[model samples]
Target: MTSATLGPLLAEARADGRALGAFNVITLEHAQAVAAGAARAGVPAVLQLSQNAVAHHGGELAPLAAALTALAHAAPVPLALHLDHLDDGPLGRRLLREAPEAGFGSVMFDGSALPAEENVAATAAAVAFGREHGLAVEAELGRIGGKPGDAHTPGVRTDPGEAAEFVAATGVAALAVAVGSSHAMTVREAALDQPLIAELRAAVGVPLVLHGSSGVPDEELRAAVRSGMTKINVGTALNVALTGAVRQRLVDEPGLVDPRRYLADGRTAMTETVARLLAVLHGAAPAVPSARALPADGISPRPR
Candidate 1:
């Protein structure tokens, strides 16, 4: 039950022509649900903490990161902690410095807001920190379509040649490319450029990551993986699923008032969603361990 880095797992996925699911953690329930889902799928998954999630907690990442690390220790399947979509350079550096203490195995230092040259420089600095800490580094090239200002403008897809150069310059272990997916889309109707994805796969040496994957349909996701996307990032889908479950729970039991009571349904719903997405990403249902193999609370049995 020891915690481990994401390098070997991502590399294995790329080699096997399968993809890993990286779910975003919003609350303690989210951490449990993600781990539980991954356990059910019998596949390793990444549990990510986004910058917005940090803002929600008043910028204190240590508490959540500690909880995720503890949960990872007792997870039935391998789980890696990742800091996702980090745009602030100072924050990214601080996270990298404290990553070992927080038990983060990898990070996605997002510099997509910067011009290409600046993005490379900033990301390369993050990569330097990763080298020092022995944690995997993931950087994005081209804007991934979802920022508030880009709604009206055409999406900036990542070019294969540029992707190759970016990887070489930054030395990132993973590269997230824009191939028609956007962040925070509630509807699952994003149209991906499959040919572009294949081209990036052939051009870039590192594993390709697909961000804003919640907007993609099941078949499209499978196609993206088949086209060489090794890591798929999902956030909004879990939020929508959890919120819908909570709303239904409230209506079904009007007397319910306790947060725990309402949140239980959300946890269940998220767990189900995670399992389904994991199954789709892996392309088959893996044989999970028996119920007794997992901790009752889906967290570490050892003392925190």
Candidate 2:
């Protein structure tokens, strides 16, 4: 089935008081796995690619771009391709242009490392660019703690008033606010400020996005959604699953040099992880029919 735009899917989730799972994709296998998981769970999801992932593949967009578009076309449930955590100015602009042309539904312009005023200014420009191209824009306000590879960064927290002002000034489709969540945490122990989330929701009219969501526990995740989080960005969990699968596969077959043999297991692990998370994000029972249960060739699931 052809995937719908990310904006509509996220808007629907927000209106219905549900959260959409936004999983990061680093390779063709990751894209396929995420789409497959979305299909299995029978829910709308976002397949995002981080700037770090793009850089890993030699800074070229063609390979992953094609992979994402193809996966979207083949997905049985609504799927959106998103550009995640992009900080570089020139590269980000290129991605902004490439996303709509490649059939992506949304793009996130992450300028969190910059000062507050510059971050807002750069994000505002990115929001304008996305709007002009008819794409949904997600901007970050107040830097979230933790670096992608390095240890956590200290002294960054989002203010509700500043977030509201940022959203109003930038006109972004969604706002990612920092409320005590850090990125790249393998353990799910982060504490979320629920009252702050509610305050931010009241302050900013747009959907609230939670970055560094992989670090939050299931209960907190659900509570965040119940409070006001419409979109949750998950990356490290999927990475953990994929790496674990590959590692175990290699341990079972010590001399395996073939990429497909190992990567296939990684994909399966990722799919399972995605399926489980989709159910949680959609607030559906585990026994419910998943996206994978849909006819393998169907465009979309029948209306429930």
Instruction: Give lDDT: candidate 2, residue 126.
Output: 82
Top-TM-score candidate index: 1
lDDT of 2 at 42: 86
Give the poorly placed runs of model 2, Cα more than 4 Å off: 148-156, 285-304
Q: Superpose all Cα atoms of candidate 2 onto the true structure and report the RMSD in Å to 1 decimal.
A: 7.1
Q: Model 2 — which ten-residue stretch has the worst lDDT? A: 295-304
Clashes of each: 0, 8
Candidate 2 lDDT over residue span 185-285, tens digit each: 77667888998899988888999999888778777788899999999999877777777778777878899999998888888888887888877887774
Q: lDDT tens string, model 1, 1-304? A: 7665788889999999999899998999888999999998888999999877887898888888889989999997899889887875676667667776778888898888887789899999889988887878999887778787652245567889999999999999999998988888777778899999999999999999999998887878889999999999999878876777777777777898999977887888888879988998988845543323323322212111
TM-score of model 1 relative to the true fold?
A: 0.91
Q: What is the lDDT, from 0 to 100, of the residue 285 in candidate 2?
A: 40
